[model samples]
Target: MTYTVNCSILLTELPLLERPAAAKAAGFDAVEFWWPFTASVPADAELTRFEQAITDAGVQLTGLNFNAGDMPGGDRGLVSWMGRSSEFKDNIDVVAGIGGRLGCRSFNALYGNRQDGQTPEAQDELAVQNLAAAAEGVARIGGTVLLEPVSGAPRYPLLTAEDAVRVISRVKEQTGAANIKLLADFYHLSVNGDDVAAVIEKHAKDFGHIQIADNPGRGAPGTGELPLGEWIARSRQLGYEGHIGLEYKAPAETAFAWAIRQRIAQ
Candidate 1:
């Protein structure tokens, strides 16, 4: 099995620019992140420094999230939000530029929370358009655009594998874009009450990437009730060939110990 550290969530204790080196020092050769910038288009210097950090640390950037707005302030994403379509579209170029330089071929596009005034039908239509645009943008490098069902945000409507796949099918049907796919984050699915095993058994081959964190506490594998190792093994057995993204939260110093043990045991 292969793993990639999600520096954005796992290495929150460190400065943003330093997390790549920290991940490399901890023995991971590949890492992923949410959009590290506050703005859709950060300054050239900021982009340079970020790219340089990854290059200097010698780690592969395997996955990245497209800029979702104000995550900590409870904004899930911008793709479907009313009046933010231009902001979301602007972000595609930046995402593509970074991915082009860093060899990242998978980009996660968080479906935004439903706005107060916009009808659900309106939001879904806009989401499909933006997702199709994202898919086309990343296709230049043989990249994939990922859609995930999230937990804890009630306004965000995509809550099951079926929900995400429905939109993916729409993108394909409307735009003829085959590059959009599902991002199966086990923690989110479990928290949202989806049968994780059944999801894997049925849709493992459709996943563009997989992220993991144990539920109840969103902690590392051993600190919670999830059979994470078994699920990962099952995913691989069912033909999910991409890296397993370690997107759990824990004390940075000890976060990876269980993962190391799992690897040795495997």
Candidate 2:
């Protein structure tokens, strides 16, 4: 199986700019990240340095997230936030510029937590608009906008494949854009109680990208109860051809030990 290191989650031991080289040293040919900036539009120099790090490391930037606000502070995303639509829209160009430069064609747009002041109908409507705009922005580079079903954020509405696909279908139907797709994350799907095997069987061909982490603890494969290897194999059998993103939490020193074990097992 081809794997891409999710530098944002895996290489926290190093400074952000240094993670690309670390991933390269760790034997990964590609890397992915959440938005690696405090603001939607960072300064030019920050962008330059970020691009240079990936370039110098000789690794492909395969996936990136649109600016999801204050991730650690519990801001899941801005897409459905009642008053933050502009912030989400403004982020599209920055994302496109970085992805365009780094050869990243897949962008994850986290649907924000539901706001107390707004109706679900209102938020869903805004999300379709913003996602459609995002799809259009990245289409210049033949990019695909990815909608993921995330776990752990209680207010995050998309916690099942059906939920995310509903939104994806809405974006395509409303905007006539075919570049939007689902990011089937095995860990999140399992945590949310989705039928993982059924998801892969029915929707693997629809995935724009796939990410993995063992469930229960979100650790490296074999450290948790989830049968990630079996699920991944099934996904491949169903024709999902994207690199599997390693987006689990573990000490950087021992993160890839499971990969070694998997190789030996094979």
Candidate 3:
């Protein structure tokens, strides 16, 4: 299994476009993004700059994220995808085109919000529907969309491993795209009361990628009580080979960098 670090870990020092260089310097095989293209919305020039950074670093471009819609628009992103009446599918197209140009093969997206007055059953149906749209976009470019569950978005339908797999399976069955899959994020899973390795093993096939940080603190692995090393070993034992994304805040760059190297070596 290869370990990848999210440039968000050092967002301040690493320019948005230069994140790949920084990640490679720190010994990561690849890098993940959280809406970095969002640094310049719909701007082709800025996206091009990002493309060059990855090339300069010689690091594999692992994943890019779709827009986080629950922000200013209060669920406009997920709602757009959910309702199927809007242009949510079109939004994913932007990610596919941009990520493809950047040599990235994967993208992450969310179900979004728990808006007031929206019933759980209704939101679930919407989530399944939107997944089909995402699948369509991925199919066009031979790419993938990793659907993630978040504890923060309680109103959203996908908030657990089981929920994510069931919905993802339904979408795959319908679209036969083979690209739509689950994103097993440890921070979110810990927040939602699930064992990290256990859930990961059960859903390994559906796992598009993996993200890690210690529980409670969500800091770098060695900083907290999470037995990250043991779990990583278990993942390897289970025959799982994919990117392990470090999406935590490090206490200090120099110290965190050292610890990360040690963890990966283990």
| TM-score, cand. 3 vs. native | 0.84
For each candidate, what is the lDDT? Answer: 0.92, 0.93, 0.69
Sorted on lDDT, best first, the list reads 2, 1, 3
lDDT of 3 at 231: 68
Model 2 C-alpha lDDT per residue in residues 124-183, reported as the tens digit of each score: 999999999999999999999999999999999999999999999988899898999999
Q: What local lDDT does model 3 show for residue 125?
A: 65
Assess candidate 2 and give its TM-score to the true structure: 0.98
Candidate 1 per-residue lDDT, tens place, 1-266, comes to 67899999998999988999999998899999999999999999999999999999999999999999999999999989989999999999999999999899999999999899889999999998999999989999889999999998989999999999999998899989999989999999999999999999999988899999987799998888999888888888888899999999998999999867867987
> After superposing candidate 2, which stretches have Cα over 4 Å from the reference?
264-266
Q: Which RMSD does model 1 reach against the true structure?
A: 0.9
- lDDT computed for candidate 3: 0.69
